[model samples]
Target chain A: MAFAEFDLIDTYFSQRMEQRDDVELGIGDDGAVVTVDAGNQLVVVTDTMVAGVHFDQDTPARAIGHKVVAVNLSDLAAMGAEPTWISLALTLPSIDQDWLQGFTHGLREICEYYGCQLIGGDTTQGPLAVTVTAHGVLPHGSAIKRTGAKPGDWLYVTGTLGDAGLALAARQRRQQVSDAHYRRITDRLYFPSPRVALGQSLRGVASSAIDVSDGLLADLRHILKGSRVGAKISLDELPLSLALTETLTQDQALAYALTSGDDYELCFTVPESQRGVFDTLVAHTASKPVCIGRITNEAEALQLTLQGEPWQLPETNTGYEHFASPIEPSV
Target chain B: MAFAEFDLIDTYFSQRMEQRDDVELGIGDDGAVVTVDAGNQLVVVTDTMVAGVHFDQDTPARAIGHKVVAVNLSDLAAMGAEPTWISLALTLPSIDQDWLQGFTHGLREICEYYGCQLIGGDTTQGPLAVTVTAHGVLPHGSAIKRTGAKPGDWLYVTGTLGDAGLALAARQRRQQVSDAHYRRITDRLYFPSPRVALGQSLRGVASSAIDVSDGLLADLRHILKGSRVGAKISLDELPLSLALTETLTQDQALAYALTSGDDYELCFTVPESQRGVFDTLVAHTASKPVCIGRITNEAEALQLTLQGEPWQLPETNTGYEHFASPIEPSV
Candidate 1:
């Protein structure tokens, strides 16, 4: 007989989300059992990826699984929560054993690395889609919120930005570029690393922080809005890959860097007085966070300066949205 | 301008999942916040409903939303936990203004009834699908499990069965039945009252329990498999509705009660002495649970008897398996 949905779940989706001390019971029951620290609070977020929307039909199964799980983990990182468990709702048009095996392997790889367990979830037959809800725990009153920034808090971002956007733009054939540029851009697009440890390290050090999910300009503005602060972004300070610079003009590259999203990097604010210690803290990690701008008390307006000359970018709000449009419509 | 996904989120989904004391910060940022309660463990579960697979495409949007959330909440009820919050991931083919309004209204009605705040969720464009991830808290050592039943425990089910299965059978024909029968069966199918409070009350009382999303026979077998026990269900004692028995013969109705699935009732095992208390508890609630069988210390087998005459109800494993045969295919 062909594989039934029952067999598919038993064969693959039945494995534990992960094995953690907090998880009293894993998969195979009505729900999952988890023990949170005595004074810790739980952190939760949900994301849905629909085929033909978030991902095309032909995207590698491994990449789709990795991206879905990684994106949610990135949310927990922003909240300074230690990952604990995840529940997955998989909707498939049909039972594809090979696709499921690859998906599970990638999921297992990430869950094991994050010390989170697979809790309880359901699988059903429908149009291909994957919805993941990841849960984590944070010490009571210890989480970093977006509204904690103050004037004079120096802004920093971990690693690069525009690369993912450029990578996406190049893949869409928006404009022609050299093979080297195309390769670098697409690679970034396919595998944007989440800055988990860096976020955890910024627990008390960074006054305000949020993940760079939307392009830097829009996402950073969230911190500014939440903290009732404004910021001046030094366009010249944006980090660019050599290949990216070779493919597009400096201004064009800067546009993608400022506005293209999907980078899962941390854009945070640390007090200027703590700058010396912050620099020392970064020495322990290979992924160095770069200083980009400073938070200000001025009314909410984001200014960009290039070599002391002012530049204006489009005001269109971007990044992922979940209402009229599905998420990652162009992914 | 098109209804940008972000604007739609801001106008609707942003606050669909609410923030509570347990939730540090609500939506509109990188992620949401939920603090773990001290000494209480968190139970997580998710269920997805596709428009045509789980529910008819023409099903009322309000009821559809309510049922999707209720079905997931049923998982928590099976675990005997008090649901506190939920996140929804909805994938839609397109934006229908009235549908959105009705969907949210239904979602909010049930969420308020259960005291579960909507925390955060995502929306995507795809076939009509809705997934809900619900979280609940139980005392550290008190979460009821599905593997604790002993052979000598009594087999019991909460409320009536077969009504939902029959309702679907009728709905497929779109034939109108008596108002009373319609009220009774439609409630069974659409407004399944999950035994959350009842399940919680049985925490220390029930040996093992599972919500009857599948048929009672199929669900009870889950307990049997997990606890390594067998069961003898007294078919005559099964709870059936007058409306159900009117159109179908007693045997056919009994078979539907035993194997047609989708009742969303609770089937469980408890010591014989707890029967009086269980009955007493049901007398106080609108929904009444019924005792139908006894557990046996044998290898996995399910036997049904009528009027003291033993009959073999060989297991067909008739719970609605995702992607099983074409029978319970995704809506």
Candidate 2:
């Protein structure tokens, strides 16, 4: 059977996700009409994933769908906004019914979990790729920016890191792991949980915030540059998953935790006055927020310490550059 | 020199567009935060264009950038919304300086003309493609929908049609045209004008509205199906450009006008009771609205007439299908 564009959308996308009262018009219109509450502001973020560049052919279609939404949602989480709606622009080399089924299922699963509705989008024939533009909402003055940190702030991060990097290394045959550990590590790489609730909880508490998509050191640099402050982090304070610690040495695990990307955990800063309140509030959350360092008055300076001695960064301190040579799965 | 993602965005996009008060945070952030007035609703639209599918290698980069923004704005125009902000998710095979210069120049030109600002977006390395999600705003209850047409509503279309189809045919060597006319028609295809002002003026007047991106007959069918009302259109009444009329026979021109896509004009319906007011309101507009049809009580039936006699549709009545085999240049 030939599936035309409209039929494909009707079969897989329309009427599949939950509808919200704010969506006056959803699919099947030239554009969608939605309302933002009286005192709320709209937050918009977009992310794109390509076939060979972002994922390998062996990656499941469901994982691709989930990752595209997850990455965009992670950005929203960084902004301390609640995900509300998403528009997907999907491109495919050909029509594959099974792939479409799995992709839509994954998309629906995450959107429903986040209470976001699939508003509308475009479907085209091209290289396999998907671009998701997510819409979020928050109170008018509650947005947490990267430029809000100050000297004497306490730096923190949610959840552990380095598992995703170790997972990719295993998948590429650079490392070996047992089946059970491999499953745990790969699950971290595939289905990253965006810290949506934690981000919201830190809206009034965090002095500055950013999602760790490009390694802990690299992402922390953004906060330092934006806020014009410095940070001193202890490598021993870096959080690591059991899968990563068991598979690699302490030094190797620290390297991955500091330089590897694809960890969707939130890296944030809290002022000294609010540290106690932040710790108390985070104690009840699912992910235990870990304090890693403190902010300094030195502008754009990042100091690292291992044990009790000062440490040096690798010769190449760059993070994941999108156009850098020898493409690897970064996001 | 390596053009990293951050460098590319900062050099080309960050400082180019106009800054607006409504945008609390623009580029360089995880997400953009924008305000919507208390009495207004948001209109969102997304469209994607791919290389080899939307345009050939001979197409100019400037045209690609302009067309992508124009198509999304056209959808907003159909919804009777004022264009405000846009987010772009661009994927490129490689970094070409000249292409980026021309593309950003074109994008900035059109955006400045429409008073729309570029907020934030994603850039990735992949096959060449661009997805633009545009946001617009309108009064809370003034959005013109596709399901609001009623019996005795007069259908009207803005500007002319079929020139873009003829332009494509000429470019493909399937048709011949004079050098002067070729530029005129190709300009129609490349730099389509989204009827932003006219669409805004149509608020509360046009019962239903849609943009003509998938040919006239195919797009009109959407309104007919959604409104559950039939239409009677006169083929001879379809507005044709001078270039199209002089290049092809009347029958061929009418056929192109009815069946070709990428016109980017507005098709709307006004009730008979408000016809006088609509005519007076449209008389002061740039694109003179032309009456070509009237709504009927018969459900989902479209009757066509040429001169005074009943007309029949061609065997293949479908519009541009995104996943259809034998890829063609489409927006």
Candidate 3:
């Protein structure tokens, strides 16, 4: 027999998804509310994850839960907003108590780490999917936007990329990988740490920014489009992790890093004059920021290169899209 | 080939889910916002629908789109909120333009009619499920809750019930019915008008209230538990549609009416001394309210009677739940 609503909620989610702190009301309430910083404007974002589209069915529940919330928070981080509250709409094929518990446990862990509160949400029987609406706040006019970048801005990213894509490939192919490498890749896929502090620090500093949920090229194109400018990107400067270099050739690793999605590390632009200041800020903080390219005044379009040779990349976007199906596996 | 993200959004939802005055941004943006009356506190609710669970694949896409938002708005209506804005997240199997167009078209119609706006949401590829988060506002402290009922408060419901249940039965049995009756019954399942005006009108006047999404018995049990009271409900007073009464015996109709869910009407309690005022208010409204029973301060339980004899409704709620199997016929 399928689990009842009360049982599934109580056993899997009730304990894991309830509010903590002076947030007043929590789960079981029709609506939940908690006070935000009185001086800040609230920022809200929503994202949804669908089974087989967002993640394969073989994906672990906890990872799926963590990744869903992580991606949404990544939006807030990119906007330089402080994460505050979230609500979820979880739909499942059947009452899989174990899966629900795993999902909520991962979600709770992330929320607790990020100082976010779970306010409220709706649950219904459906094809497996999870939609999370997250709330954040930043001082009025302080939130970062893509339209802020200008000519001569230095483009940068935090940490390496493509480990997630490699991990996905390995998993899909059932390849035997070193446990350490597999762990590294899965961590990249599942637990993308939103650069919250780094973003908050960039508010008055960075010209414009966005998280790299899409491939670097696609996302940077968004910045270029929004800012009405062009860019001179250096493929050689693309940050590759030790894991990425160890497992693949430089060209292959560079290809994957340039186009891999799901790496929630931020890609931002700072005025060239502030480059020294940004370097100092990164030096002062635990998180390191890497300057990879520069924004240009010319509007000819993005020019990707390695040592000045024109670079080639995939014609389509990486990972899932709301409108389209996955690219046919080339491997 | 899978669809592209922009194409997916445009083909499925974009034109159909157009912007309204209340919307500061819509589908194309990172997030969306709707302004609320500063004097009124916001009431928010979310609900999800899955293709095989909450609805069948054969179900009209327009109905699915409309019902997704309608259910959440029903909660706000139960709270006496003025419907204002909504955000939607949809996951799909493959991008199907026709389905999306129909769905969004239906959704926009409701938004226009209810004076609400589409704010923002995320679209990702996945299995078929839709999640909608709706926001509304009501005068601070005037939004009725389910815990305020006291002894001697009269139980009332707006409109009739059980028609949707009969309609479902008819559909399953392939029974033909008159067009007018069919429209009325199907409307219960599809276009549930959230009692926003009536709920807002009853703001301080009604003692407590809830939306009749679950059967009256189960929903009343929720209020009784919250208020620490019992209720003596008269089955005879249950308002039944003429079509339902004409088709089924009183007992069968009463059973469906009492236990059937999906009646998106308001069920509330008002003090007896305010009967004249309540009556005046109801008589002036489009959805006429009917007295069904009285609240009694006692051990928590709900007792229903036809001519003062006992009647047992469904002990467990079977209306809808998250992560449960899809309704059998739908599957």
Candidate 4:
């Protein structure tokens, strides 16, 4: 409590980031002034994480900071925008120097990688919570939207799924895993990588896109509801991590892939005509884009199949709804 | 707790605001896409208010909602930007139908009045807090900054000061006031009007500008430090509302005017050359712009005088620092 707001910002945030030319005025101002490229439109996204709700005390402060920024940037990536600037409103119950150091370190690492500038924000004393508003820009008319999916579009997801869920299960003692596998899987939960480059490459190639934060089915529902289309996905086609597959049964792994959240991977649709182009674009990237389903004409209907046989979802079909229930540390 | 996040947004926020043309995609998207005018730059500011820290149980939910937006808009006003869009991150302990209704109603009223669109935000379950990030637009190179003041510039303020401070004093039982006076003063504390038009008008004329949210002298110190200039102000010229003057002794009112905060009025400086333009522009406005003092050659020094005699500031020179101490409801 002895740390003044100005000193806290100066010590932790102001000098930590590199300056950008687009930011006319950065921190230490009433409001930040930044220029958007002439031919680009601004994409804005905001996400908030509360200590006990979005995360728990067992979670590292560094991971908490990284996850907060990653979540917001994931939304920007879903819109196929290049990250540019971020403003963070951080509230803390008390100031712990070690916690502050770790948190800012995680924040700076992601920001440096994405080439985004920390413009300005507010810091207050209260229960721990972080609200980040990220700003990005894309060429005018190039933003991929949830409403743009077509009935004949093919569904694709970048990277593997269910690793975060598997990590959560192991941590909560619902499942046991080898030490090495636990480390790798827990990293997936703590340090989700926003598909920035993949999203940028998907702009014209993909018809519609969204990030897998609210589980694959729930997020796909958004695309279907907006585009007024249906989807039929193959369970066998789901990309699963080695750790997830090794730790859980086939059904449980598939269930986690289908219903659990916080993957932060890109789920998108590509028209059949552009399938080759999409394949060529993602061919060199580290993310393995896998085709899992196809859009259908039936509005708002989702069909699941396993090796050509009909399949059904688990009873807990509801995805992450903030106010519906408390979010346990394990997803 | 039964209300889903989507329902919470749709029922209270989605349909309430008028659609804006510049907002290409609004709520119900992974991210909101907005267009900044070709020749304009973006001004961004974020502010967070915590329940017990920023307000108390007695504070109305409507006032909380209004003040959050007002505070951010006040920052944009300081930058001489035209308010455009807002994103809110709201955390609540639990669902209260009446509180939500009043809060959203207040939010809608302010956004409608300011011509700002609510693009998107996150609603979560946690301790009660609200963080609002406001976006605005200004013509290229037109932003007025605190670093622009020069020695010999004249200092001026928009409207009266010390009203909010007096209201806080009355509410905390530190001062006594008539019922009518209390109502008038507390209204100042609850629903502060950001001087948007006045700020826009001063874009070219004012050398430096800042919103007085941390008392007059503390905010003025920012201008002085940034601009590397000093200032000499007349205590007799400090404008006090009739409600403030009627409730406290002259010295007590001056102390509040100098040290108390949450006024949201603009304190700015104008070089002698542009003084005529500033006076002429503000002549027709409701806010009576008053000249308080002049900038001095000494760097980072502030001098006070009353009727041409040197004066001393109150012992409590330190201003509001969020983490330095708790923000009582009255403040």
Q: For every model in order, what is the number of clashing pairs? A: 18, 0, 5, 0
Best by DockQ: 4
> What ranking emerges by TM-score with the best candidate at the front?
4, 2, 1, 3
Model 1 segments more than 4 A misplaced:
A1-6, A15-17, A314-331, B13-20, B174-176, B273-283, B311-317, B325-331
lDDT of each: 0.78, 0.88, 0.75, 0.89
> Total backbone clashes of model 1?
18
Candidate 2 local lDDT, A262-302, one digit each (tens):
88999999998998898799888989889899999899999
DockQ of 2: 0.74
Structure candidate 4, residue pairs in collision: none
In terms of TM-score, how similar is model 4 to the real structure? Answer: 0.98
Encode model 1's per-residue lDDT on B1-331: one tens digit a residue: 2445556667776664433666666666556777766778888888998877888766788888788888878889989999988888888777888998888888888887888888778777778899999988888878888899887888888788888888887776644456689778977788777788987888878888898886777777778888999998888889988877887767777877888767888888888777777667668776767778889999688887899888654455465666753334433
Candidate numbers, best lDDT first, in rank order: 4, 2, 1, 3
For each candidate in turn, the interface RMSD (Å) is: 2.3, 1.7, 2.9, 1.3
Q: RMSD of each candidate?
A: 2.7, 1.9, 3.2, 1.8
Q: How many angstroms is residue A278 displaced in model 2 relative to the true structure, after the best TM-score fit?
A: 1.1
Per-residue lDDT, model 1, residue B99, is 91
After best superposition, candidate 1 residue B129: deviation in angstroms? 1.2
Q: Compute the DockQ of candidate 4.
A: 0.79
Tens digit of per-residue lDDT, candidate 4, span B1-331: 4677778888989986957899999999899999998999999999998987877778788998889999999999999999999999999988888999989988889999999999999998888999999999999999999999999999998778878877877777878889998898888888889998888888999999999997898899999999999999998999988886887777777888887888999999999999888778888899878999999989999998988988775575556677655345332
Mark the regions of model 3 whose C-alpha exceeds 4 Å error after superposition. Answer: A16-24, A33-39, A174-178, A272-281, A314-331, B11-24, B33-40, B174-176, B272-280, B313-326, B329-331
